[model samples]
Target: MQSTISYLWHTDDLLGQGATASVYKARNKKSGEVVAVKVFNTASYMRPREVQGPGRQKVLVMEYCSSGSLLSVLESPEHAFGLPEDEFLVVLHCVVAGMNHLRENGIVHRDIKPGNIMRLVGEEGQSIYKLTDFGAARELDDDEKFVSVYGTEEYLHPDMYERAVLRKPQQKAFGVTVDLWSIGVTLYHAATGSLPFIPFGGPRRNKEIMYRITTEKPAGAIAGTQKRENGPLEWSYTLPITCQLSVGLQSQLVPILANILEVEQAKCWGFDQFFAETSDILQRVVVHVFSLSQAVLHHVYIHAHNTIAIFLEAVYEQTSVAPRHQEYLFEGHPCVLEPSLSAQHIAHTTASSPLTLFSMASETPKGLTFRDPALDIPKFVPKVDLQGDYNTAKGMLGAGYQSLRLARTLLDGQELMLRGLHWVVEVLQTTCRRTLEVTRMALLFLSSSLGTDRFSHVAGRPEIKELKEASELRSRLRTLAEVLSRCSQNITETQKSLSGLSSELLKNRDQVHEDRSIRQIQCCLDKMYLIYKQFKKSRIRPGLGYNEEQIHKLDKVNFSHLAKRLLQVFQEERVQNYQAALVMHGQRMRMVHETRNHLRLVGCSVAACNTEAQGAQESLSKILDWLSHQLLQDMTKGVQTSPPPTDPYPNPEPTDLVLHMQELCKEMKVLALDLQDNNHVIERLSRVPTAPDV
Candidate 1:
């Protein structure tokens, strides 16, 4: 038998069980790899007659998670305090990500609860939660109605409950919104360590809980007291006061719960709406801290409109340091803390390490330099201009321009500004890459929405043309991202090389002419730095600032004209079924863009190294050639003249010559390697796709 087939998998240690399947801990004997095996119970009548082997059994194998389920953690007495706000949000984020994935694939996981959420321990000891149990999962076809009433009772949507209670021959079908409702319930349970509407005690407790879920409002939603919205329903349930959640969090949570748990399916929160709301709330409610000193640290509960002035006040309250005295440095440069500037705006601008804040009051320089905070904010906030001409296509164009500008900055001869520019580029590249993924997802969603009959009114030839254009733009932007990523990597390698050379030069300061090489390399690095700064000033800062302002303005302008145009398009009858093609094209573009950028920066440092190598090669060649001539002269003298007691070329002895030759050889080898590396870098740069003209 094959090793895979012969490998004994021990499945006796049971982990957990549900109505449909039993999970057991197992280990592969051959590989010693641990796994979880879930065996589904199949009735004799349901078993397929064609399945004659062990494969006939309904079983699924998956990776084992040591931390177990979220339900287990919540129920455990050790975790009575429940998860911290950050940890809880992380869990919710993971679940949301999974749900988003499911929704994208046109599948609905009817059961989304704490028990179904498993935590996997990473190598760093950090826990990553994953959604499991697809037993109640179903794929919905276009125009197909979902009518099944299968799911956990406590977590079921009010719509589902109504359908179940009515017992009609045919009821209104549920959509992907039901899954979101389940998530809301799961989040509530995770946060409070107890179900929201489920009542305790009484003979018919299950029925009562169902009734409360279907009919009653959330306890937090009541105007004055933690009671039902309509009237005080007689139930033996006590709200868990142990949650100790912040007012800001509670405010966000209440509305989210209300939206999800709405009785009308039409009123229920969609995936996109839920994601945006939750993401915003999570960002605001979270307290981010900046460690000024070991003894002095400042923390602020972030809000949408939090300004630099507010942050400084929070810090001053913590450390008794005034705003003027509190100089914030990020990556060794002073951070601008403008009173009118919003924290979110700064975050978008400084994509590198936006949260990182270093106080430089004690070690302040003679003249404190303050950067304009407005310079950092993007001119176009895409979210704000949702209904404008500055759509996804325009956004990509802007991103591409920024990337190209960054690449140009790296190559520019600005030694003093390179360091800061390099830092900015690194941050920008990371942020852009992440944003690209989100853009891809959005494109997918847009394609899906436009393809269906729901948008048939506007799905005309012009709209199809626009969609196609967007797809192509997305492709171009992805390519630009790749190029930028590769360029960033190359820059890193070049920096490392420069650092090594600098260190070597520092150690050999007394060596003849070594000081000159050191100065040259330093000059080269300075130029690179200057180039980076110029890039930031000319490209990054202006682009971001302009974009932010434009977006802000567009956001404020009533997009009534744009809305009218869309409405007009929708009314047109010449619309084509081009959505499917557009979607496929987008998917293909996404796949292609996954390829990493191979563009490399041909820095002045590489050029300096090449010059140094050439000089060394020439010098080495002369020394070797001179040594050969001396040896040849000595051999001729021995043959023609009487042998002298003293050796020829004795001022620098033969032993010394050999040692010098060895040293020269070593120097030449180092030079050769440097030249080879430079060649490789140049080759990479040559292969980079040319940037589109701005």
Candidate 2:
């Protein structure tokens, strides 16, 4: 006779059986539909509303997950070695999410192997792996422990295996970390498609030997017997080469596995820490492909916290080229990239541009390129105009906050500003020092370029090269002068607005609950405005003024046409000095331009952040408008300058250039010292009060 339980269904076929339940294929008599019925040996399974059973037994009905288990996924030919990094991370995220849910409810899942984890394909076609088969699960606390062993043999904790399988009568209690151990094993299997520990013959036969190998080694050590029964243990820290994990990912994964697959439970990371680490990796890890001369270096993993210098050093280890020799060319443009920028930031800013190897080795000695201004330039400065720093700030502020959240958000923004300022100050100090160095180098070369007698033999004709060169230098100096002066004026305006607002808050500091927060924000604004103070430092260039004397001299030079036959006097040696001077001039120009860029970013960051509140939009609009107008004027002035000279021998009169650079050097020294000494910005930011709980 076919096995039939209740009259409501027919159980003509048996599906599967487990430790506690037997699944049977059944047909609903009323609906004439087929389904699977789970008949548990116990009286109940959790709490079922409409219970169906023979006598006191519980017959639970659940929708089958037709997609099957993670074990099946591992069994596929594509996943024969293991799931790919992307797929593995997906599985990890889903499993951890499920584990977190279980943890929140104070339940421990004793069985956490791949077989118990089921894959569900949602209607959107996204794969979601969920924890199933909760038969071995029990209510457990962090501090609570159970002595009963209730998991698969291979995945079970050693202590539980000793007590349950070996029947050793060992006095040990299994804590919630038992599940963590099982998880470690399961994840490794999902990643590498194999168990972590093994003996010479098999797990079932050499259980004791496998347990010895697991516990005897130090933390993170992988050991197993290879050939002989009593052979020495083979220890290795890396995954098998046949495994599909990239070297970069393996580096990150091995450590995590070592931590969680620890023999001692105290050494194991709890689910919370594990989730945090994995999520952090998901957030910061980026894989890049680096190629040089047809040789591809694949899977270059860079983190957000790493600087370009550090990344280059890592690349050097892989490739023989040192950091100094590595020149990155992206989209055919030689990258004038900063070593201090975050590797991820560099990657982000570069977009999909393929970077090539360097040809230029060695550098212009360190002190040549003086500090360009604006160190605390916001991180969100976009490559394109569409999603610039302001837009980024607006996006961040769009997530409206209230009460404690509001206070916290404000505090965080202030802190971010502070950190940026602190880093900027350090950068400024270096920039100032380098500026001084470049000034000296220019002065040194200027005398040589001016004293050269190579042109003495040539007939004096209306020198178009001299005129063009002098005009270009004058234009650069004029732009620098304008940037500094306008930056000061703009800062003055922002300060005026901020000072008024800060003063108003100060008057009611005692009555306000956010007194400290207000003070902190005030300090941040003060710190930002403090950058403007550098401009006021004694301008050794006499008003560091319009430098009109040089511009007037440049205008006087006649470059309209040659008066006589031009002489091709090959004075390459003499012109080399002029070239040196030219390089220094270019460096100095870039420094001044950098300041403008940084200032622009800072202004945009502040304007966007403050405009989130009421009553400041008009003031900010005026400030930004003034800035936009001034910057536009500066841009137009640049456009008016002649393009680069075609001849390399084009020379400018060095007297005016020498004086300007000398004065610049003196001013830079003073500015560098002043910036180096000013600890108030950091101190003030550090003093910003902590956020309130309420």
Worst 10-residue lDDT window, candidate 1: 364-373
Overall local distance difference test of candidate 2: 0.50
12-60: candidate 2 lDDT, tens digit per residue: 5555566556766566666656555666765344323222223555465
Which residue runs does candidate 2 get wrong by more than 4 Å?
A: 1-56, 59-63, 223-225, 293-296, 300-325, 329-337, 340-694
lDDT of each: 0.48, 0.50
Q: On residues 1-694, what C-alpha lDDT tens digit does candidate 1 reach at each position?
A: 1123423344457789875567877767767788777666654224233221245444566778889999987764323334655577778778878877887788888888888899988899777999987756778633456766766666777667655544445557878788877887787777765566644442135554455544566433411122433444443222233453433355566677767766566667777888888777666634343332211122355676788677667656654556665544355344555778876654332222333332323321111111221122123333433333233222222222222222222122111122222232343243334333333332332233223222122223262343344334334434433443444455455345435433442342223222132233233333333332333333323234667656444433323223223223322310111222223323322222222222122323333334443444445445444544554565557644433357453245444544554554454455445445554554444332221110
Backbone clashes per model, in order? 27, 3
Model 1, position 506, has a per-residue lDDT of 38
- Listed in order, each prediction's TM-score against the native is 0.40, 0.46
The model with the greatest lDDT is: 2
